[model samples]
Target: MMLTILAIDDSRTIREMLRETLRNAGFDVHVAVDGLDGLEKLHDIAPDVIITDINMPRLDGFGVIEAVRAGTSHAALPILVLTTESAPDLKERARKSGATGWIVKPFDDAKLVSAIKRIAAH
Candidate 1:
């Protein structure tokens, strides 16, 4: 099956990069500019997996994770967070909010794809 993936990031460049990379890898990709927009898209279509960024204008990555986990329909959905913040405290908070995995910024395409496939496999 072609897995549908939702990628949320405030930076248009990162969003497009992820979308293209995943698409070339044979996955269906959808994108949102920020957390709030990502939430709206999540409600409209529950993708197999969600990849998000930590810093955003509307709702940050943690906020998205909280909202997704709080919703009965999406509570169990898998989420991989890609962010620049590598602090242990931030990762802990993300875990507390129910993030599935974390990858620091400037990630290699291969690693990112591997992580996505791993999470989507679940």
Candidate 2:
């Protein structure tokens, strides 16, 4: 079965772009505008991996990672926190919250896809 990826970011353009790119890469894609929305989507369907941004309305990437780690259904799921922030402290916090890795924003599709492939074992 194809891996399903849940990508949460505030930018509609970024979410759409990621959905299209991941779909083309042979993975199922789901989108959310922010961390709250991501959690809602998670209730509907559990994704193999979650890619998210750190800054957003309602809730941020850290909150998403925290919620996921606390949730019994999603605690074991892989997460990739994609954001503009490069701070070591933020990355460390995300790691503590259960993020598998980090990626900078405005990232290339190849780099993003490569990250997903590695996470999904594609």
Candidate 3:
């Protein structure tokens, strides 16, 4: 089965990059402008994995993770935080918020795909 991914970011370029990368890797990619939009799309898409930016308008990655974890249906879904922040505290906070993994921005396409595949396999 083709896995579906929901990628949320404020940057259009990042979203486009993720869409292209994931699509080329044979995954269905859906995108949202921010965390609020991500939450909305979450219900509609029921994606196998989610990639979200840490800093954004409306809501942020932590908020998105919290919201997803609050719900029963998608609570167990793999959520990867894609951000420029590489601070250990930030990563810890993301983990506390229920994120499955972390990827610093300017990510390697191959590593991203591998991470997604690994998470989806679980």
Best by TM-score: 3
The C-alpha lDDT values of all candidates are 0.92, 0.90, 0.97
For every model shown, what is its TM-score relative to the native structure?
A: 0.96, 0.93, 0.99
Clashing pairs in 1: none
Q: What is candidate 2's local distance difference test score?
A: 0.90
After best superposition, candidate 2 residue 35: deviation in angstroms?
A: 0.5
In angstroms, how far off is 84's CA in candidate 2? 1.0
Stretches of candidate 2 off by over 4 Å are none
Candidate 2 residue-wise lDDT, 5-78, digit = tens: 99999999889889898899888999999999999999787898999999999999999999999989778888
Q: Given candidate 1, what's the lDDT at residue 57?
A: 95
Model 3 agreement with the true structure over 69-91: per-residue lDDT tens digits: 99999999999999999999999
Per-residue C-alpha lDDT of model 1 across residues 28-71, encoded as one tens digit per residue: 99999999999999978779999999999989999999999999
Q: What order do candidates take by TM-score, descending?
A: 3, 1, 2
Candidate number with the higher lDDT (2 or 3) = 3
